[model samples]
Target chain A: MATALENANLLSRAILTTQKLRISVSKTFNHMKDGIKVSQDEHGAPKSFASQLQEDLFLINESFIELEKLTMAVRRQREAETIGNTGALSMDPVTDKTPLYPKALETYKWATRLREHSAHSQAFLNNSSIKRSSGSGGSPAKRRKTAPTNLNISTQAVDNLVMNVNRQFHDVKITKIQLNPTVLQVYVSRTLQAIIVLRGLLIERVLIRAHHENTLNDDGTLDLWTASKYEVFQKITEHATAASLRYYLPTMQDLSFRSFMHWLNSFSKLFSTPCRLCGKYIKDNLPPTWRCFRTVEPYHECCRP
Target chain B: MGVTCVTQWPVTENRTVPQAVEVLTKRLDALGASKSGNFGVDCETYQSVPTNVPLKYIHVMHNKEQPYTCYAVTDNRTCLVCENSFEAIMHRLNGFYVPKKTARIESKGTRYEMGDFIIKIGIVSLGPHARGVLVEVEYTPCVIIQDCWPLMVEFMQGFMGAQYTPNTHPMLANKQEVPFNAEDTVFQYLEQFENFVKRGSSTATVR
Candidate 1:
């Protein structure tokens, strides 16, 4: 207990030092100058901040897509394990591993590759004379019709995958499925996914900003991180495993979802009732912070990061 | 993420002017809130929340290095730079202040003043439709007590009645009335304050 308290004190001092440094830097920059307001973001948000945020999300998005695929792959692996003379959940780590499930590796790689496609697409946009989408500025009914497609990885594949995965893992659910002739994105959540995003720092920023946004403002603007972020992350952290954001970037870092999950799962046992919100078997009592009138299977505050 | 950081300022939702009237009526009964009949405040349908903090003044800033902090005509950082800097401060005022615009300044009556700081009250009124007018007042309040508005920041505390009072942290320190820092001459602050009022008036329409 004394060590924990000492650590907390040290952390506070470190945080204060950083804040003071920023303050000191700001103090130095004060000098009289004439200026003009030229245009709205005529210069744009500090490019550095925007680029970092965009890069992080791009990799995370791929990581999530891969994690979705891995959930299915694991179900497939579990199927093989079930049929082989082993107990339902049991698989021989050394010999029974087989070929690392070719589909899982493919899914992981595909997830990691998405960042590259995004970067190339962005480059293509900048290189060409085409302007970014300001808005469609037309009636929705007048939009272009869909093109034809013939492929096994059609919308049907997603539906089948979701059905198969959900049948095996009752807690998991594919919340959204998006399909384009070219790029496809699927959003799946089972409480665990949201937690992974939070662990990656997305949810914390969103929630902190949301808390500061006062609801009393006359303007009809909602804070970015309402109760929903905590709810989502806490739920995901408890139920899902090896789920995180993943994407590929040709010119940048390629974050892996499975790898992050594998990393996170190593620590999941620390949370006493991980995925308490969605898990079928969870004790009734919940911690004060995580108590929700909405969810019957409540997560403990201690379990949340 | 929120589309814009500025848009997400804290505010109470769904307040009616009549609610303010009722609240004021109750406020009168509250201890130390002027219970005398003469001490009552009247609202001109001021039920809705003002877009900016009440009594907040803007200062001009022109500092070269910290442009955000310098040359701003804001008297206090919080009054001008705080979240709700662009909103109407006072919806209605019973006391009429002389408009700085079109008001003649005499060369004789003015006393020698190199650094004697004065305040400026920037106001916007709904004149003949929603046309915005930025009015500046040379905040020469008759008495120090009349200067109810102060920079919305942590300034030195003054005695309420000769007793020392401790200001708590997270106490919305900017809301209290206090004079400018003694070390930082009042004249410099006033100059900064004037610039704030001008910028606020110009930006009022867009904001």
Candidate 2:
């Protein structure tokens, strides 16, 4: 009677262990599914998808190991039940050494540890990857942080420009010089004013002209028209107008030569033609297709068919 | 650059405007002051013909001593001492600003020089009528108002006597501790001229 009762007690304990393992296994599977969903959802960038998939695979392997342990527990529980039903007095010595409850506890701990590991790795990866992305590229978040710094840089650049201009034409007194990032305006003595747009160190678009009446110099060295400064300014103006330097100027720091060349090629035939229909000068301000189809002459929007 | 104070002298008992000017001149001459040149500060008020915009005035004050610059006060109260004359600037803004009232306040008297203090006693006139005496005392060496105010008061007291105590003009009253500028001097003159105009006397037309 005592042996039968002990066997029954062992069987019940095994059954209880199996039930707990089953519950824990189901819980682990649910938690793993949730973790994968969380990782997938947290992937804000498309480039992180491959790495997220690898993490998901790793988590699934851990979950499979937990599932395997739970299945082995259930098999042991079945064997113990069968042994108890057959009224066998002696228990399996190996089973007695490693009880179902202790092994189930171990698997449960492993499952929880795997879950925590996945969560910790996900959090660490999210932070490190975000830092890497924001550090290098101009994401909206990164751009917002750099906006004030960009303004400071531009103001400093303007200060540098004024200092350079002062050094360049120290002989000619500059009455006033104003700079707002891209454009630098100078009002100098001798009725000369210059408006300059700089793309890096290169002068992209510039207009230098005499505002007042052309007076002879105090020493009678040169008149306004005969001055080398006037000649150089005129040459620059002619070059700018002929080449259409206005369109060539880029406000951004990085100048893509290929894109600029492509634009030049595209817009090559779309300039400097007189309108046949209206018999007026065609300005580049209007569209290219404003030219007549057969005549190859530009026309006003109203005059064009 | 130096501290300048403008004050109106009280009309004396049984003394005509010219007589008062004469007495002040004699006193100035007694103190070893000499006639330098005539100085005039005239203001031409202009009301905008187009409605909604406020009335604007152009005060053109020319010091014969400083002949190179014409100190013209446009709508912006700040004095623009331009190289161009008042006539040139007025000609440029002819259509925009039409002259309404002209305050013809002229100063013709001895400029007393006693140490750092320079004093001018002018019988300020309104066209034909002599309005009052305009006394201008300047501390030539002092750029700070607080440092020079006491010395200026003492000098003025020596000539003005105990009967009249010269109060610091409203403009200088608040900015006593601050470093003086050319604008502060101009502002004092403008304020005195404005008060003289507000007395509702006969105003002359500026040609």
Candidate 3:
């Protein structure tokens, strides 16, 4: 704790010194314009200040490294304490010798390759003038209808792989599926609508936004995350996850969903009750009826009654 | 930080401004909505003189709810919802902006509150002539338009009846996830006020 405090103090002092050095460097530049020759070696003070700035910058870098080490140490300690408490609920380590199910591995590989296809398509788009001839006022309906089938062979293959993976979990149903050359939008059961867009072969960015039965748009697509909608989803999911830990395990940095069903199964935890409003541990009880249409917080029928 | 719905109530045959408001307020009160106070929103329009700067209107709107802020949209399509010092900033740009068409279309009526829902029924006026009614319904707890629209519509229906059916507001289109704020609410009212101005003289229409 004392070392952490010392590291923090050093970080702040280093930052302040860097700021002061920056001001002096700016002042020195101004002095150079005011007819003061920079090569004034007799006084040598201005040159010393420039050198001092370089030294200050080096100190700041060192302090930042020290600060990062201190923070990571604290985080590791907290994580260890948590793991100790939740002994049975430890995350599945990726290096487990047991090979993943053949279908699941194939699906994962296909999804991973989507990132590369998206990049290649993007490069093709950039190099080609095909979009300019398409006209600016091209409607969305037309865009969907005219989407070239030849370009989406990889997309269809991945879609089939994803659908097959979801078929493994009995209750997890995928209601709608739309595939573009670079993006896939999937409506999973009733709880979540996920849009997976590829960044590269390494990055399959999955944006799972909230979906509602009544609020479905004319296009039959869910509204993407806005700041407010994301907050509402986050709050409800967090509250639900806190109430029950069995279904929704915490996500790590890698964020690789095992299968479509694996991701869909987590949404069931959002409806887990003992009612977030009443805060009673009602075992084997019926799910709360009335959920806040926006936040999706479940409440007892009697509470909202 | 909340979703707000703004719609105009076109005054029709046999119904006076006060009578329409009273009827609506009473219906709201009956439905457990309590009166908070009176509320008003106003806008001032200015144009830059041609000799010094470009010819365009600089609209600045002030809302009673957000007293400290001013929503100023310039001719260049730049919008700034800034502090009370916005007037001083305008004054500094004297060569650029000169008052052209300043219409102080205001809504003066009672504010009502019920749980997370806030309803304001105002008799909008231009000078002495009562133009129409402006009803603003807000769901304070929720920011997503998709989440709050139903509740707002339900609340408005209780008082407004069949006349004020909520439509897809053009300003709110493509703004599903964007958390509606005070600036947006004022902009919607300004839009309605602009439409009223475009419709020519309110007294002429009434006559």
Q: Pick the TM-score winner.
A: 3
Q: How high is the DockQ of candidate 1? A: 0.01
Best by DockQ: 3
Model with the higher DockQ, candidate 2 or 3: 3
List residue ranges in candidate 1 displaced over 4 A.
A1-153, A160-177, A180-235, A242-305, B1-207
Residue A212 miss distance in model 3 (angstroms):
20
lDDT of 1 by residue, B1-207 (tens): 110000001112455433433432342233123221111000011122345445433332221112223222333433333222222343233132112331111100111111111211112222222112111111111111112123111011110112323222211242343322211222233433334345556877788
Residue-level lDDT of model 2, residues B39-139, one tens digit each, is 55444454444543666677677664466766777666867777746667676776777656445665555566654456777766656667788888875
Ranking by DockQ: 3, 2, 1
lDDT of 3 by residue, A94-161 (tens): 52553343344466579889988999998887566353322223764765564443233354455565
The better-scoring model by lDDT among 2 and 3 is 3
Supply DockQ values for each candidate: 0.01, 0.01, 0.02
Clashes of 3: 0
| C-alpha lDDT (0 to 100) for residue A8 of candidate 2 | 65
Q: Considering lDDT, which of the candidate structures 1 and 3 is the better prediction for this target? A: 3
Error of 1 at B9 (Å): 27
lDDT (10s digit) by residue, model 1, range A115-175: 8899989878756643222222333343232111112235555445445544543433323
Find the 10 residues in a row with the least total lDDT in model 2 chain A.
A259-268
Ordered list by lDDT, greatest first: 3, 2, 1
